[model samples]
Target: MAELPLADYARTLTGDIQTLAEAEDGSIPRTFTRWALEQLEESGFVSNMTVAYHSGHGVMVYGFGYSDDRSVLDLYTTAFSLDPMVDRLTKADVTRHYRRLLAFLQKAGSIRGNFDQPTEVHQLCEGVEKLLSNASKVRLFLFSNCESAARTQPEPTEFQGLPVEHHLWDLARLYRHQTSGAASEPIVVQFDPPINCLSVQSVEPNLSVTLAVVPGRHLAELYEEHRTRLLELNVRAFLQARSTVNRGIRLTLLNEPGRFLTYNNGITATATAAEFVEDAEGRRVGIRSLTGLQIVNGGQTTATLHHVFKRDKKDLDGVSVQMKLTLMGSDDLMAIVPSISRYSNTQNKVTLVDLSANDKFHVEFERVSRTLWAPPTTPGGPQTRWFYERARGSYAVEEAKQQTSIVARRKFKAENPAAQRFAKSDLAKFVNAWSGLPHLVSRGAQKSFAAFQANVKEQPPVIDADYCRRTIAMGILFKEVDKVAKAHDAGSHKALITAYTTARLCEETGRRIDLDRIWREQQVSDAIVQAAHDLCPLIMDMVIQEGKHVTEWAKSSKCWEEVSRIPWTVPEELAEELLARPVEFAVDTREEEEEQLSRLKQIELSEWEMLADWARETRALELAEQQIATTIAAKLATNATITAAQVRKALEVYDNAIEEGFSAFAP
Candidate 1:
């Protein structure tokens, strides 16, 4: 086994031979440099590549990167050591130039994500790879680099110690537009990596609430589980260059959970909880480890905490973790935490453990759940509490020793394990039912949206949601469908699907939600809404037009466009059911063909003309039927007595009557 370094494994698999060898030395040869330039041709990475030469052999090149709107950043210098004008410069100056250029480049989207899979550049992201000894410390490795014009003489730009410029760019853009002529603006652009953003923060005291979490992704499997979205960065020099990476926002969450205290009026926060003596024999029970104080309110209803930053919800999984929550405070005040004595409504102890103020407690639970909601309207009539933390301290940090000191413990026989008989009063069941709402809706909507996509011939069908929203004049939602569908991020695509589904569902109920004017509500971002509205109508129009052309030969020419625009006159769902049967088009049946062929033979051209003339004349009482007595035309669909043969026979009768009159004249 190679037993390569953890990060280098990726570089070894997909990296170029020349690039990999010199990646340690931080240089690229001409051949690989040329390769890098061509890889990003279709990608919106570089605008133009130009080369200049000095003193006949010395060469210099400058790359200019532009944003979509064509705003220019400073020069992106690749390797100028070959250029004669810059060749005389000291190594120190070259390094400074590269660093300065990096800073400037980051001002745009100048982060090297993955050098290996050049094709997936826009679809991926790269971060740092750190192995911090934290309960939630993470390491992300997005391997990427860029090369200039020289084909065989360059190494991709890399980071041995640098700041993540893309995030910086995003932050700056977010701020620049938000502030209109604010004094806080900085003039000469200076990018210092790890720039700290300052804001006011407050920490509230420990409050009690019941919480339950369902296990999810393992921390180490962040990218493995979300490989579809993660941009695989070059891990080649990650170990040597770890200093240049940003693991993510760092913060500590302090938690101390106490019991819910109850009084006659209602339940409230507990100030303290009493501790119990250790008993090894008889009824065994497990107690919450060292609990006197808890963080958060007892009746925490509906709360959602997304990451403060736009960190991928999945990257959070990469955080290696050891969570810690502690219970430490005055023993006297702790008695108030689980006070069944003072707050019990009935004499039979207490249904819920009561809490008193001023008790400190802690837990070693990692908060990995994406968003937690504890609603007051819990289904089981129990309140729930939940929190989302960015970073947490190590649970192995001397917290295991504190586990012995717990408050009142619940006990039951092995035959009837207390866990087996948790009541509606228990906290676990309450949270499960309440917190499942969003996911439940999303899962259902996913199925419906997929079905619609399969049926729609258009590349991206207008979200059924947009249709409803448009009906109600919500122009923004009507517009966002297309944007989300083609977004580089799959999450965004899924979210777009969900949004469209919800909008459609809402419309089906006659909610009067206008999608065309969805911008009025401002529920979604402007870009997303515009993308949907602008793209959907064109797709619909195209599908309709194409359908018109295709079905023109099959349908009557005059009605072809109408048929195409309306597509199927019958409902789509019903069409499937109808198609399942064995079909027999009446026009194609052999029996019908024979009848049409036989009828054609009876109508001769002379007879046809003679019959036509007689029918036109009103004075032709001289037995017009006598002119066409041998006809054998088909009968009417509901022929009571009218057949082509009967008409001919009647004409013969008229001729006989005329003959009889002539004979009487001769007599």
Candidate 2:
């Protein structure tokens, strides 16, 4: 497929931004920043970014983030123009934005005290100061709506003795990223002195494997340069100090560096291409470079080694680790990479749901979405379908496929409008809110999807036509509530308000909010919209009154508990429209109870005793709940039969403990 011209793409992007801003009642800069960040995150360029726009005193910042291990800090800013025709960004413009971001870091201490009370800006300034204290490197990203005319980036400089790198993502670069159809920009690694390796035989024409022993120092340097990009395909984040595996690796590095190769299971990696050197006998013997390299397994080992090398200043002179590198073409990456990632980590605790984009549930849901059309709101209006993009950019791919004919493209879009398209994370957020998990939804897309995936794994819901209808209804309700929330306050805590409102509505109505009616009508009622507007302020007040960072507070389960306790009632008009949940939609309580009991019984008596003791020590549970935990532990010790009510109470206590920040596997 041919790429769109840069000028045309820019105009198209401008239209998209305008449409999004209008829908959310937000500013252009805010909408563009959010949209760009989402794209970057999906491409593995960034992760877990907190969007907090603050600008004043010759300083500006859209958001900030840090590496999972706190070794690298990221600050982002935007240079947006109102004119789509303005297509070039000068070097001076880039430097000015860089200085604005640097000024934020340099003056964070004094800027933090400028606010009388803690606000988002003040919290961000304080966070910057704290994260920088231990950071070894800082990255300043400048996102522009125009293309950069310069071909070279600014050289790396130092900030507070830490190296600072600059990255520019202009329109031309973003356009390529969107059209390239790759998950992330290809990473090209060149070896100064080529390392020796042995090629393995493979039956597939497009597949090749190489076995090599990589120096520990070289591996550490690579990790420091790429950070989490190397582990993007890995199932889990770096486990850090809490993981026993990491601890063992650390010990081996400290005491027995020479034995590291013998103790470690090594890493499995994949690449699009590998350059090899052949010996006199025409045998491939060494690797000179690798393109699009990604670590599919052994993330914990790689991260731990990097940590020890940087933080402890350990000498890796005798340390060496094994590597299995698989080479394949870009055409095979999307089809085969997930399987490689999934199978490589099978022996570990990684679940199939961790890489859930290709899961059967989502596949079935996408099938239903494509085949099932919503009833038209008007009697004679055209019926439309909700496009569920199972993968990122699938909607665009489908539209591009029909681009040979203008009429065909128009018909494709009219039947499945861009406004009605949703992605996996969107479905997770909508369903989680309706399922009484607004806290999880507020935790950000990656974590929220993880929680949602766990629930789906536990229950394994059947994705039928009825299920898809109800899911789409939840999406409609969320969008309606979001529109009302954003209209009232465009800049502050709109997501929280929308999520909490939907969850509260579900609780107050006892899960009888007439979702079927919403599905059939293809819109929310005015009464519910009004209810959302009325409830948003109260939710905001509750969230802010706690004097904590709004994002952090919303992630806490206590936030939901307190908001659920608020003395509010649904409007009478909406109350009359509520319908009892259909019998077909009801879960089998007996089966669910049995599952819960089975899971609880799997826990060891000692673990239960420890949980009870810790709960009492932390005061996480009330006296009655603490006593029940103790009773359950005792019963387990004696092999005594526990009643169904006790099992229910024990399960509640476990959940509450988790909410209180208790971790069963914390070191």
Candidate with the greatest lDDT versus the true structure: 2
Worst 10 residues of 2 by lDDT: 236-245
Q: Write the per-residue lDDT of candidate 1 for residues 630-660, one digit (tens) a residue.
A: 2322222222344444544544543554454
Model 2 residue 110 CA deviation in Å: 3.9
TM-scores, in order shown?
0.17, 0.79
In the range 1-667, model 2's lDDT, one tens digit per residue, is 5445667567667776777778767778878888887777655566556667888888999988776566788999988877756657888889989999999998888888986443667767766787799899999998877888778889999997999999999987887777765666888988768888999868999799999888888898988888666776665642221112378899999999999999998899889888898999988899999999988888888888888889899868899989999998877765676677767774566653244456676887899878899898899999999999886656666766776887986797688876688887789899899988998787666656667766776677767788889999999999998887767652446677788888887777777788888999999988888778777777777866534656667778999999999888988888888875631353325567787889889988877888888888989889999998899999998989888789999989988888988776877
Question: Model 1 segments beyond 4 Å from truth?
Answer: 1-294, 298-492, 502-571, 574-667
Candidate 1 has its poorest 10 consecutive residues by lDDT at: 234-243
